[model samples]
Target: MSENLWEHRPESGYVTGTDLAGYRVEAIDGHIGKVDKHTAEADGANIIVDTGVWIFGKEILLPAGCISAVDHPNGTVFLNRTKEDVKGAPEFHRDHHTEAPDYRLTLGDYYSGRVL
Candidate 1:
């Protein structure tokens, strides 16, 4: 995983404090879902996408580094990953997601192209 996996890329156009909730999240191939929640923490930035109906109401947590761009005008957040990649990610456990170090490491590894 990138050392900066939790930090937003400078070229992603993600302005700090920007409200990303409700913004559409698009994978490399197609649309995935909307942002259910997010954080702009300097080191732990991430977004929780609620994949309504598309994945049977699954929610996935993506590190900021996965974002390729943020089109504020269009209300879309584009990701470098594909739908299959996102779908194959570690199951999101809401209760432990935010505070678990293991979860973060696993997610980081997944996004870094390491076999899970």
Candidate 2:
């Protein structure tokens, strides 16, 4: 697995507020989805993507660490990972793993291939 893209990095000026909802998310290869919601907490930030009809209506949460850039003008969130990487990630269960720190750890481990 690859390392967390934003590890040890401070929030870039491009990383705006939760107002990013509805912005299209672009993977390294191509478009993935739009931001359904976003949350910024003490630990980190995350974005809930709504892949409308792209993968049978699948929605996934991506850690802010995965973000490589934010193009507010274009209404897009660029990710460091490819679409395949995000597709193979552990499925997101609404309200089940959102608040679970252990679940997040597992997800972080899954992405970086290291215990977090």
**CA lDDT, every prediction?**
0.89, 0.75
lDDT tens digits by residue: candidate 1, 15-86: 888989999999999999999998888778999999999899989999999888999999999998889999
lDDT for 18 (candidate 2): 43
Error of 2 at 49 (Å): 0.4
Structural RMSD, model 2: 3.7
Backbone clash tally for model 1?
0
Tell me how candidate 2 scores on lDDT.
Answer: 0.75
Best by lDDT: 1
* Alpha-carbon TM-score of each model against the true structure: 0.93, 0.83
Writing each residue's lDDT as its tens digit, candidate 2 over 29-71 gives 9999999988865455678899888777988988877877787
lDDT of 1: 0.89
In model 1, residue pairs whose N, Cα or C atoms come closer than 3 Å (at least 3 residues apart or on different chains), thus clashing, are none
Error of 2 at 20 (Å): 1.3
